[model samples]
Target: MRPYPSRSYQAIFWLVFGGALAYCVYGLIVGDLYFVGKSGRGAHLHGVPAWCFTAFVTFLGAGVWMREFSTISSRYRTRFEILFLVSGFSLLVLGWNYSP
Candidate 1:
């Protein structure tokens, strides 16, 4: 049996996406970032929570990388996108969840 190119690429895309999603979710649940709060107010000025921003950026950055992948040859496209997304999301999740 032979595999379709598009299907194979899509499958790999999803595998990478799933890994990124799981990494973020784990950071969220285990890191207790939920309790840390997404946004809040104080006596002075209301401030946006950094974690929420990080999460947003990580998830959105994936889209940017995906777009770039379209211009590259197939040989490196999947590999680049996979590693980029996985590492980017993982770092974002960990950094967002961690606080000094």
Candidate 2:
């Protein structure tokens, strides 16, 4: 396994991670982190809940990226990365579209 990501891959990862972090910050600042149902009702996901969700996504992504350079066996890296990515993105989507 490579000790570090290629320049292109690093660039892409940072772009995505930065966007996610920015979006979280924006949502917190605007106090508009929520989801509205078709029935006109809304569920608020601000404050602690928003922070928790943001932290979860942020850390998950960071961990996956950092894991690429770890000393662990490469045999499971791909599987682990896939699992982390899918679960992380799923949670992010769920948080964006659903209420706790």
Candidate 3:
């Protein structure tokens, strides 16, 4: 397996990861997990749902871990990477036109 990236890179990754996780948690707690938008018809709309946002972040986070960690077996890494990509992409598409 290849070596991990520099310390600074890891630090930055963790920082962003932590921040995203914290934000997700805060949103869930506050019930403000969705974005509010005004429709052309003067109707109020909601963006992505809370569950989709949380799942996307979760899958992406796991994918990052699988890519970075040298300790995990390669056999499972590829499978998980594919799963993550598919899940994240599906979530993105599912939320692309959310307006309910």
Candidate 4:
């Protein structure tokens, strides 16, 4: 289905992208680059920085979701909205619970 010709989706997409980009910058400035650590077995491994990576992935994923979300059909609208809300809420909860 063709996407509706509206700028709202683009605005949202850019908003998310910009926020995530800002978070990455903040992470860098605030010394939150904990992307590597030792495991239980003492093996060094590179880990994903929770907040930074989450925001990064969300930024990337938002593009795809917004593309689908902007479509003219209503078939996936509710689902996308739910997904966006749930994912966003869950991220907030996770951040709150596991804040450093």
Q: Pick the candidate with the highest TM-score.
A: 3
- Per-residue lDDT of model 4, residues 1-100, tens digit only: 4635457866887787777667666655675643334654332112234563555456446635654545534656656766765675666465545533
For candidate 2, write residues 28-75 as lDDT tens digits: 899766656879788667765687677666768766774755455776
lDDT of all the models against the reference?
A: 0.53, 0.71, 0.72, 0.55
Cα deviation at 75, candidate 4, in Å, is 2.2
TM-score of every model versus the real structure: 0.36, 0.56, 0.70, 0.44
Give the Cα-based TM-score of candidate 1 against the true structure: 0.36
Q: Least lDDT summed over 10 consecutive residues: which range in candidate 3? A: 39-48
Which model, 2 or 3, shows the larger TM-score?
Answer: 3
Q: Return the TM-score for candidate 3, rounded to 2 decimals.
A: 0.70
TM-score of 2: 0.56
- Which scores greater on lDDT, model 3 or model 4? 3
Worst 10 residues of 1 by lDDT: 41-50
In the order shown, the candidates' Cα RMSDs to the true structure are: 10.4, 5.5, 4.5, 10.1
Please rank every candidate by TM-score, starting with the best. 3, 2, 4, 1
- lDDT per residue as tens, model 3, 1-100: 6777888988888889888878777787776664445754332223356656777887788788778854668888888888897897788667665667
Query: What is the Cα-based lDDT of residue 47 in candidate 3?
Result: 38
lDDT of 1 by residue, 30-80 (tens): 553232335783221112333443455565556544544355666676676
- Quality of model 4 by C-alpha lDDT: 0.55
- What ranking of all candidate models by lDDT puts the best one first? 3, 2, 4, 1
